[model samples]
Target: MNDSSVGQAGKAATVSARISPAGGLDILSRNEVARLRDVSGSGLHGLLRRCALAVLTSGNISDDPGSMFELFPDFDIQVLQQDRGIKIELTHAPAQAFVDGQIIRGINELLMAVMRDIVYVSTQLEQGGFDLDDSVGITHAVFEILRNARTLRPHVDPNLVVCWGGHSISREEYDYTKAVGYQLGLRGMDICTGCGPGAMKGPMKGATIAHAKQRRRNNRYIGITEPGIIAAESPNPIVNQLVIMPDIEKRLEAFVRMGHGIIVFPGGVGTAEEILYLLGILLHPDNAGIPFPLIFTGPKQSAAYFEQIDRFLRLTLGDEVAQHYQIVVDDPAMVARAMVRGIDKVRNHRLDNKDAFFFNWALNIPLAFQQPFRPTHSAMRELSIRHGRPRHELAADLRRAFSGIVAGNVKDEGVRAIREGGPFDIDGDKDIMQALDALLQAFVVQHRMKLPGGTAYEPCYRVRAG
Candidate 1:
């Protein structure tokens, strides 16, 4: 293995080593390697470096992507082509990923995943393997990405529960998430989460123990994230399988399509965005009678939080929307029991319809939900969050509204946009806007918007109720 000394920042030691891919990602063509090495404006080098750094610093909590760059200013990664295989060379890499001069096995696996996804997405998706414009095309692309990552397994019973919640959560809420995960794990259910910290980590952590007790081997803790958010929320160490989707919309679609059920804990705008996205799709007439179970859950103290969310959903989407999900509070056992029952129904439904258990091919996701929403000022302002529209359409707009807030809060480009153009302006129906504003204010007041003890979070959007 070739090694060279790279300069380091003050007191932060770095390492340089050539390491082989740990997770069956050894083969790479010359063109693929060139794309990864290319540092030009159109190349994938910068994206690869940023994502690699995120993988190296897994479990280290810091929401600021810029800060990570500053901390490891000299860090570099290169994909070296060899006659036998490919070798990943790291320069000034994070020392924490190494223990006693060897990289941790889990981190190495994740690093390979990062490289695998980056190379695959650049070559396959961007270079015409899939058309990303049409709705069906996008879905096919999503399926292809997941399939390439080996995420979809056939003949598996429907037990993957997608856990949605904020990375910034209270200690009690975090524990509650673990409790729910423990219950789920005890029932042989696997987990799929956005896979950062707090709620994301808690469930996987709890499930690990329960899986151990049950002697459940090869239990999947799947983490799906995108490039825009990966830097802000680094993957937790608990993520056994990680797939980085091309964008947030695809990531959300992956969650709903892959998991049999979804359980939402208290979260900020991002979680709200996820909730709206799923509810919007479920509300579609085409999706009616689908057995995709969704549950809103939290600890006893978080009852008010779910109450507010429920009230907002009812007010905006009508009471009928409640049928799509059930709210469970302070009852981990009940959550798991409900999930098991739900999964049984999902299994029966999929069998009756002859659908695949690993992927939901029957769910009809509208084109609006598939297309990426750029959270520019004008785009945010033009969202039609009025009650006069169809409930699903209204939910779609509201989801975009919250998505904009989430982008402004954590995404690098959105933060830069806010710094350049001030907060995004969101104008909509009077009652809906008032409810939206109140919910956001509560998120801020409860320290849900940003990680606790970080700098005070300024509003990223101005709500103008018509």
Candidate 2:
């Protein structure tokens, strides 16, 4: 790596370097390279630059998506096609990503992942490689993307656990996540998450220690993210294997289809969106027999948080929805033990059905759940958050409601919309609206809506009980 300090005076310190690709991504087609270099509105360069910068500044904590760009105004990345392989050129990149002018190995690989996924999605998925219009095609696309990233491990028993929680969380809750991860690691389980800070990083961090102590090698710490959320929550350093899905919908599907079990920590609307997405699928009549383990756990202090989630879920989706998940508060050991037992069942079920252990191909996901729901103000108002619809269908729309709030809170496009058109209007059944309003109020009070110490959060959506 050839790098030089381009920072002068009090400006943000940065380095310029040309480094070889790492982590098996050594080549790119000329067309792909050109597309990555293109700076037009239709080109993939903007997406590439944003995601590359996010990984380059891996440990920074700021929810504002544009802050990084504002801080590093001159940063730019270009793919240089070479006779040997591809080389990445960095201009005014974050100095922290380097030590003695050498790029950090993990960040380098993650940067490669960013390039790999962006190029794949733009050239392959969008260029008639995937029939994104249909449900099966979308699932197939997801599988192919993960396969391309080399994330699928064949012949391995079901052990990958997808942990979902808010980046913005309390210290106690974050530590509790680490403890649970430590136990899961001790049992030889791998960790997968959104690849951000706080809850997403905690399990992976704890698992590293356990893996080291247990003499476990070739352990996987996977982090799955999409382009929109990556800027707000940069990928944490603990993620050894990083995969970027095409969209939020695909990202959620990847979690359910890839992992044997899911452990949800206390979080905000983003976490709520994940819960509704999974439960909605599990509640489907076809998926009723599936033995996927869903556990909601946090420290004792989070009992009330779980209670609020429980009430909202029960009221909206009916009492039977609770059958899909188990709630265990204040016990990391119990959570790990329960997850282990649940994965055992999942393994057996996969065997009985002749399904692969690496991917849950037997599970049914409807087109509604698979399709991306862009949260424009109009779309937010159109969501049918009512009582009498089928439980699964209602859960899908309710998931959209929270998903819209998540977009409003973090995504750049959604934030600009909210700024221009005022907070999104979420109107629904009187009881459901009241419940949703109360839940969001609690998130605000607990500082779960944004990273702590940031500017006070303004309401991005207004709830109305119609």
Candidate 3:
């Protein structure tokens, strides 16, 4: 890594250009800009700086948010107020985010998106305009966030495939994701992901090739990330459409709401969290009959990995949970074929019900699945992953447990928690805990936890799934 202090990260040439909002953020009040600039520790300035740096350093290929901070410790972004519109100014921005001393057009647009959502969310949070306490209200918040970003396109079909997988993945597994995406793209499917590296980038990379072959114009590579995750996983260049949700909960909600189907690639805790979230919702009686397609696939060598995951799910959630997703190994062709057929079902169901194609409005997600889960020390301890309760509720707590681990593993706050409190203690049903322990150990052994070339992996939690 090049060692440049924030003092010399980028060439110092100030450019002032007025840009209008493409979709939602054309105008903002002076009061809003002042609040965003409220850099007084409690304000949004510092958080905004971190997220903007992540976008500026898109395709940086590093999972460590600290590294980016270290490289550009002096970096800062400010919203310039004007009568007609807004102007974004960057100080000591990452040199790569710009070309020829001018910020890339895509990056510029993405940076504005950051400003738009952050401002809107901050306004809502302070004003109490969003009833985040209620489940339906929380879902509405998610929808409004996406709508404000102009992400939901009307009159479109169910073609967006949300691919969930690890940023740290095996080369073989990554290749498999590309191949699967290639097949999906050839069939006129678009790609959506957490929008980072590894599996996230692979499908988009593959689809670009297939999209070109089909001469598909105006194809979308959508990347949805929250402020917490964007730091660790910057948006890959292939993401033409980028939306940064306010938090992880909304980000997950946006995924299920926007995509037609979901494809799971090899991943770590974050991927596991996604699986649990989807399973929790799908297992709900309301969502049982919904024809949503969920699949878990990897290269032949990854059979053992998926086997471990499947075992854990069956033990914890029940064997019936297997009814929600398919296990396809070593067959990208089969993976793509299954998703195509699955989406066809989604289309037929949506058509029969007169639902929107661009977004799945019919999937019934409970409020527990919609509320933002802040992983504090007490929150981690309160998670009830025991047996005998409703299956969907258990899945929600289980999802939060994994999410806490993910936050600790990569997200800044979770990392800070680990540094102060050691690893989070996860206690639950004995058999389920054992299954989760084995699955997590396998992930560590496979180097699926963190970006390579760093310190050795450490267990972030004690799993007592007895």
Q: Which residue runs of candidate 3 sit more than 4 Å off their true CA positions?
A: 1-7, 10-26, 451-453
- Residue 247 alpha-carbon offset, candidate 1, angstroms: 0.2
lDDT of 1 by residue, 225-337 (tens): 99999998899999989999999999999998899999999999999999999999999999999898899999999999999999999999999999999999999999999
**lDDT measured at residue 417 in model 1 versus the true structure, 0 to 100:** 92
Top lDDT model: 2
Model 3 C-alpha lDDT per residue in residues 242-308, reported as the tens digit of each score: 8888888889999999989999999999999999999999999988788999999999999988888
Q: Clashing residue pairs in candidate 1, if any?
A: none
Alpha-carbon local distance difference test for all models: 0.91, 0.92, 0.85
Which residue pairs overlap in candidate 2's backbone? none
lDDT per residue as tens, model 2, 374-424: 989999999999988999999999999999998898898899999899999
True lDDT of residue 156, candidate 3: 81
Model 1 weakest 10-residue run by lDDT: 1-10
Over 4 Å off in model 2, which ranges? Answer: 6-10, 451-453
Q: Once model 1 is optimally superposed onto the true structure by TM-score, how far is the C-alpha of residue 462 displaced, in angstroms?
A: 0.3
